[model samples]
Target: MGSRLRIVLGQLNLLVGDVPGNAAKIISNALRARDELKAHVVVFPELALTGYPPEDLLLRPDLTVRVELALGEMLREISGIDVIVGYPKRQYGKLFNAASLLRDGKVAATYFKHRLPNYGVFDEKRYFVEGTNPCVIDLQGVPTGITLCEDVWEQGPVEQAQNAGAKLMINLNASPFHKNKGKERFDVVARRARANGVPIVYLNLVGGQDELVFDGDSFVVDGRGEMTQRTPAFVEGLYLVEVDADGQVTPITGPIMPELSEEESVYTALVLGVRDYIGKNGFAGAVIGLSGGIDSALTLCLAVDAIGASRVEAVMMPSQYTAAMSLEDARFQATTLGVKYSFIPIDPMFESFLGALKEEFKGMEPDTTEENIQARIRGTLLMAISNKTRKMVLTTGNKSEMSVGYATLYGDMAGGFAAIKDVPKTLVYRLAEYRNKIKPVIPRRVFERPPSAELAPDQQDTDSLPPYSVLDPILERYVELDQSTDDIIAAGFDEAIVRRVLRMVERNEYKRRQAAPGVRITPRAFGRDRRYPITSGYGAETKNEPGGNGPAGGI
Candidate 1:
């Protein structure tokens, strides 16, 4: 009748559609927590069974059947301590996002999520039928409340639990990372705990799930509304905490520290994102094009840091126009990072494209079309290598290039994953500098040399676009800030440049849509968080015409 209850928060990274593998991982972590940490209970994040936001996969009955089978096996495998894990459950011909409370190899309690968030990359309502009841379970003689991700975000579930006479509320979540979202999470948990007069444990999933990267900044709040235990964001591990009858919780003495700054946090997030994406999918390794530019260098460093140097390969595809210093720096960086390096001269392919189009465009001057052709040829070679070696190709285009239509559609954008597709050009430089500060793997010329596509002879980025110092700030306001063209122009930028940049972004919709999924580090990312219609008329400075008129825009 007398027992001290210890709960382990399993902030694990689950692969989408990998039900059995995910179940095995959950059971292993639970055993470690129960045996090694001597914890009485373990709770994993929402949708840990089939992974978070299964997206269109939920429509598949076979996937659900597999999940159900996996859950049954997981229940049978789990022993000793109680377990609270999330999974998709179908009851009476309806699908529900439910969590099972397991003990002695049986489901003690099951709670379906009440609030189905449908906004901003979430379409839960469309897929799940809501559960209207509250679930309260007896944990070591004290009643504990249970809720899913969005359930605890609002006050209804928390209040219902408190009214149900529960002393502790545990929330399982798969919350995606966004700038300033960690603080917002703390605020919500503290407010809910203080208002409900009960201790709360907020657990989130970690690692990347396609375009979404869950930060896993799990924490525990006391009844008095103080955060007692906080797990690091963007990493995977078990965070153990002890909750008392008085509703006071404290972090277990171990090796978990708070994540540093937004940039550092995001950088680590990208590393974990890439690692999980490659590892979970069972890729032998990853291949990236080393353009001797900042974006590729940063991505190479991240890939090496994620899966080690031996697992990362860098290829230098230089055209006749490629700078000698750029090639030197590319070789230097490849050697410095100790990754597999190769050089494939793109001049032959470039000439082929030019010859193929020579009859059609004999009088027209060589332009970006020709440059894109060269890029496409390089892309073809990289993809061929990727197909031959079974290694995933990592595209190195930054958010800036992606934003302003600066990237080619099937050319540089052809890859299994775009490691930094959400990172801005300016941040690309910053991360490169930060990486160099550690071991100086990237050559000085990589940073010092002008950024270029090197498709045509002596082609600098500044030839067709503004400097990153200028372009990145404009893009921040337009993409992240969600400012309209007029708003951006009013934010202290040249109207002409804003208009041109906005036009480029609008015209590049088809390209961005075709690009691979990448790590999302900012408040708004390119893939999911930032959504725009391809057939639209709104853009940067077009709002204010000569008479100050244009089409209205919406986020």
Candidate 2:
């Protein structure tokens, strides 16, 4: 290159299925890079035109036509700077995940994603055929190679590009966020860069689609496997990086955004996930049942931070058994945050339902059925408000509760979005504390008080389940890590508690199936990440040896 190619990294947040809108974004960002940044080239995230994981929308033939038109718009409208953007392409009656390079108003080169990932949330193999060739093109006298997200995760694609005499590589991605996901991506990409001895430009899409949230921690790794530039996570902007013709990525022209702490990163991911889901779905605002517990408290903070307090509504539905402290905290939090707040007692509704069922239950003893009735009363009221006000209801249940069926289906689980469905109970407290550190919105008493559902008089969570300090770890092993009951007991948990927890998890698959989709902060979220049959008899407890202390049957 004459000097060095100043490449703009387009870390953008795109809505799925809006081809024209996404294309307009690609055009605007590309033009800004050329005119404002005075840049030679700009790289957009994978599937920028159609958004990532278009899922079965790729099955629509009209989507392909829309994509072609969008691609034409980018090629015609963006000039003076080369634009390499991703889209789904069709050739010979087969679909491929493709990236195209537009140079001088003509197609210069195109690279199909070689590796089709088919695990966890990705189902690329079902929709795309694997590509076989390596694409290396000359960019302003520099020999550059191209690859997609999963292509860089494995060893073969990078090797193929290097063997083809590529001096630099640009990999586009739509990788989603999970805990420690950034470090994992960095390790894998750095290893590939070092193995191939070529610098790489890593760009990712940032937004939320359903439960999946993409964190754009885009960076550049030098030839020796050192990351020179790292952009901020959960932010969208055009970042700049310089690449030399000598097969080296020079220092970034922009400032390196610092990496976030675990609490901060997860918190920000939840905020972004909530924001995009409401905005993309065109909801007027959000309505959350503020129960004065850790899950709901943290969710209230995230909602206010996400779409702003004006757009969020916190409703306190106090039942006859609801604690006085809970009512105090709920009102305090909503007032402190300045959201549209209201209160509706469920005693009258709960009593009417009970009166209707009294004659039929003459001999039956009152039990959890009554508790569920109260919950359903609250769910009905909040959903009614959501229907009339056009606000989406955000569920407050966490992963620990959902894993073992501590939640009531059609009752507490009734909502459009479950903001903290994938958050563990312990992490909920930590996140609540983290938000308090920023601004003391949640009261300290909410953290210090023993957790309770307050459905029954003096009811505590520990009365029906293990303490969360022990419960969360056992769940992390069994649910998230897929460990057997025996394996968990071997890891130092009590055998009976392990089996009971495992049984709850196995039996509750049906409940999780019906729960609303939420942000996935862990490796194995319930809906999309972990897929277990609800009707299976081979529960985790049965996986023990023939002479073991496993449970006899699932709950």
Candidate 3:
């Protein structure tokens, strides 16, 4: 048993469904760590072969075969250094999220993920069958305990490894990012390390896969539950961590990297999420309707930053109610950012729509119909540009608007990606400010102005909804915190406003379901994060029955 051992927690980024590409990444990183760093072994994240949560791609026979072949290739290529990698292993008509220990051009051992998180953003139960064994093997004569992502989180597998005389635990993960997710990981790893009386290497996959963004904050903790090294979030690279038999980890000295701030980390996560989504799907560019509002301005900035300014186009679709300052601000911001800007008035289109519906609405009062008509007209024009230019339309609705149905369906909600759909209005303003801090990209006037849709004359958002300062917190409590109407009201919110907001949220379930994929910064986003039935009688109306609505309320 050598006291000197090198382990590389290969926190690498993997593209979903790219079996060959992902396999190449795994082998490349392993070789780099083994040859260049002179590490004894390199470990990859959970399901690194087919990419984490291959979603429905696992159902394809050809894709599964491709993944299996790639896995075999990885196993056959590497020899000198042992490789601990995660991949899908098929056995007896069941798919297991398993990790393989490869040495001397063959798989030495394998371990399956035990805990399949079926709640919130996870759907592992729908895809994988759980495995019930602790994968403990010898690495350079040191006992190494292998556990897949979710397996390390629970007690049974890690405890079983300790009971089986394992000394070090290596957990491969493809964990997704959610605001303070890194902190959660640190806490969990610390607890596990302390309880197991052994060091743990927590490695994760980084990159954007659909709405989910995995932040590779791969870290190491000693037996005393002390963090030794950490890789930065929202980026990809080989993080080399050396562990001793005494259960201590120390960073292999090279380029000393500065860690990102919480705000910067989250901000970069959103940018990368959007960048990968656009780039991976092969969109020519992104088209966003810039209304000189905070949400649209922030979205435009992110779009330009994600892909170059040349790749982004900002269109101003002003209706009759649009203010002159708004149009100017929109133009100013777009030009300042070097993004292509275009203005298309919607009054003519509005008139045509009104004429078509004139007889039907002959005696009815003009209300949200006019507002929605303006939205639909803008949506149509954006879609037209998108269809012609092969650019993806970018929706700018934030979580605040999305939570209460403030956005118009098939109108402002029309896009291939909702860049800021998970961000709340208050955070939207903060992000706008954050963007401006680097360089004043968004016009100060845009932030100073009162928020409005400008769908109808003098239509301010505050006219129909509570102030975002008030609304966002309440929405966060109710939506993210899953607070009841009574709970929201107990938090000092007006009962009537809480009820109204909850009602709006419930009624708009259909719209949210149809909305495009968006970056999820919050714990619960509109996409896969929050799953609710569209055609449901279940509202705040059902009570304390776990997954049932307790009362009738709106948000």
Choose the strongest candidate by lDDT: 2
For model 3, the local distance difference test gives 0.83
TM per candidate comes to 0.92, 0.96, 0.94
The 10 consecutive residues of candidate 2 with the worst lDDT sum are 546-555
TM-score for candidate 3, please give it: 0.94
Clashes of 2: 0
Say which prediction, candidate 1 or candidate 2, comes out ahead on lDDT: 2
The better candidate by TM-score, 1 or 2, is 2
Per-candidate Cα lDDT values, in order, are 0.83, 0.89, 0.83
lDDT of 3 by residue, 1-555 (tens): 427668877877788888999899888888899889898988888888888779888777787789778977887877788898888888888988888888887777988888999888888988889988787898776787888777767788889988887888889898999888888888998999998788888888999988988989888887877778888777788767765554343322323345666677778888988999999898999999999889889999899889999989999988778899999899999999998999888888889889999999999998777777788888888999999998899999988888877777888988899888898999888888888999998888888889998877787889878899988988888889888888888878887777777777777787788788899889988878788888777764632333233211111
Off by over 4 Å in 2: 246-254, 540-555
Determine which window of 10 residues in candidate 3 has minimal summed lDDT: 546-555
In model 1, the runs with Cα more than 4 Å from the true position are 1-3, 246-256, 538-555
Clashes of each: 1, 0, 17
Root-mean-square deviation (CA) per prediction: 3.7, 2.8, 3.7
